[model samples]
Target: MSTAGAHTQHPEHTPGASVRRTREKGEPRFPDGPKADPAGSHFERRIRSFQPRRSRVTAGQEEALQRLWPRWGFDVDGRQRLDLAEFFGNDRPVVLEIGFGMGEATARMAAADPGTNILAVDVHTPGQGHLLGLADQHGLDNVRVGNGDAIILLREMLTPDALGGLRVYFPDPWPKKRHHKRRLIQPAFLDLAAARLAPGATVHCATDWEPYAQQMLEVLTAHPGFENTVADGGFTPRPQFRPLTRFEGQGLDKGHVVNDLIFRRVPHADQPADRAGGDHGADRPEDRDAAGT
Candidate 1:
């Protein structure tokens, strides 16, 4: 089966360096689909987007995308595909989660509240099935899935004030010294996230990787649109709304420390249009132009 519980240098297995062997070619894998090929790269053709396309999104695939996905969709230009009235059940706040592994924590959060909708993204089918299964089990309609590069979805499709919050927990921490470019917590992503958030919206990220945690803090602090919600840095006790997943429980047992960073979008009236810095709408060169908010 495919490695279900690991990523590059993940705490679960010391990343991939210690593994004596990885899945061989043609090896069968779980979720058993095009994206789940153990030997392939989920972000390479990069449907979550953010890269040149070697693949295409077809009709059936779109239908599956519609089904497997939550109500949100970004067009080619990275704009919202639906109106606010259609996408939300109420004017209730929305939270977007990037790379939720296996839907464990997500399901718990959705079950805890009916007034909020959390959009969770990832590229694994079995994980999607697992999340959907859990949601079905709980009759949760508040959770949605975005099965690709969340950056693309955030940067291209979503609009300002489109979200109330964002969450990124334990994403792949591309550790190689040269692979830092591949790390997701970059200026481009932060800007996109800033635009999508309602002023004062929160962007919460957690990581077990020390370097990544540090980088996230610096990048977020430097960005003009946000400020750390907490006065001091370190694990913000898992808020009661977010469930403590099995994986997180394992991390606690291993003496690994998880760092959580929360940043709030400076309000719109207080932050000028220029502060938007070219990320104004879904049109890409940024929705707002040249402004840093």
Candidate 2:
């Protein structure tokens, strides 16, 4: 299939000897489809929470990318701001989903809730194609595929309080202690997410890795911008709105204890526009101290 923008190296180039082959000077993998490096050189580089996976795209998936991408897919190029209402052709509240594996759950969620727009972001080419194909197959007009680093989309493309909700399901745990900083649920990420999410919006995250789940809980709890939906300040039961994917089912079969955290964005005094006020009780001293602010 098309490999447009499919470089093996991280987007942020590493110095020294390179192992991956360089494409010829003017070669374009997929001229009419999602770009390989959508946000190339547009923003400062940093440690990323995800790795781009290179896989063989099936004929059907390739066809979907070539045929449907122009209609529903977008490159997170960090070049301009996106008007969510115009992007989805409606004023429906948009929900941002980071790292949808094959997009089965995303498609399901969109099909179930047609009123809410789902902007799913990921770096996997096959999964991107698969999701596109699924969206086309199921007539999921509410679904949109975003290609490239999610951080760029959040930090550059979306405006403050532009999103109604955020979903991070089964993110890479970066299991090694040394690579914990690469984890996506860090305090810095929460800060950015909180800034983009509207007041009272839910930030739902699920993970099977115990340590990562605990870390997510701790960081989210400490953030002054969020408050747990559960009154006990613990993990909440998996809500019906979030479909159980086959990957999650396999994890359950293997006895993995999946933790779902539902934290709501708290309206801040600083954001006058977002001060519609659901619950602003996150200004506690302990929460600020834990957030190291």
Candidate 3:
């Protein structure tokens, strides 16, 4: 018998029949929430820095995504440029947080510093919903959740010097030697990040992977657009502003050493004017690793 005929005959016995019946082609998983693939076909496929994870979203998360997403969240479709001032409804300096897992720390930071706005980007659906819920619960109007690729957000959406600060807490180490190119702290990623960050803005990164931390130090040091905040050009202590996440705490419990790198974006008057537009020639980091904070 043909597969379609069999399914038609035994609709009750067909696997995922209910799901298939409810969801249509090209329809979003959650109609009012972040898109599954926001950047769809607008950009070329390339080596990605992070991998997406398959996980279930909780009831509360689903509710939050449905209710709060329209107000405080947006999909990174790479379709239009965003005005940071207008998006946040204020002229406060906007800090771009590359990957916020579950948004516990992101919420805390937003609560602590209400003066600064945080645009937290992540591909994890549950995390996206959870963050939205947290922001709503805590009345954090300063928090905005961005779905899809951070690279696309930087390259296609945001204007030059659109960010006041950038935070990358515990990005994927990509420990395998063959996968180092997929790490988020590569030279090419730095170039793009530097272009979006305003001069004197701080690019703060933290990680427990020793080798990756060293690589981050080296790359930031070599980049002419950035300067290490520490005079000694070594790892700096984690700042008070950055909350200690449960993931980081667990790594510390296992005797893992966490290194923090705080580099300031410097003015590039002597360099070519086009450098501020970023180097789009290389494969950009797509999303944050699920294992990352």
lDDT (Cα) of model 1: 0.61
Error of 1 at 13 (Å): 30
lDDT of each: 0.61, 0.82, 0.81
Instruction: Report the lDDT tens digits of candidate 3 across residue range 1-293.
Output: 01111112233433222222356788778877788889999899978888998787766676677787888899999999999888899878788999898999999988987878899999999899889889989999999899999999999999988887889998888999999999999899999998888766678899999999999999999999888878789988776667899999999999999998888777778656545324221111111111122
Backbone-clash count (model 2): 1
Q: How far out, in Å, is residue 292 in model 2?
A: 32
Query: Relative to the unseen true structure, what is the C-alpha lDDT of residue 221 in candidate 1, on a scale of 0 to 100?
Result: 87
Q: Write the per-residue lDDT of candidate 2 for residues 1-293, one digit (tens) a residue.
A: 22333223444434322224356888765567779899898788899999888876665566667777777889999999999888899877788999999899999888877877889999887788889989988989899999999999999999998888888999999999999999999999998998898786778899999999999999999999998878789998777667899999999999999998888787676667545533322332212322334
The regions of model 3 sitting more than 4 angstroms off are 1-27, 270-293
For model 2, the stretches where C-alpha displacement exceeds 4 angstroms are 1-25, 270-293
* TM-score quality measure for candidate 3: 0.84
Which segments of candidate 1 are over 4 A away from where they belong? 1-80, 233-235, 269-293
RMSD over all Cα atoms, model 2? 9.4
Instruction: Tell me the TM-score of each prediction against the true structure.
Output: 0.67, 0.85, 0.84
Residue range with the least summed lDDT across 10 consecutive positions in model 2: 280-289
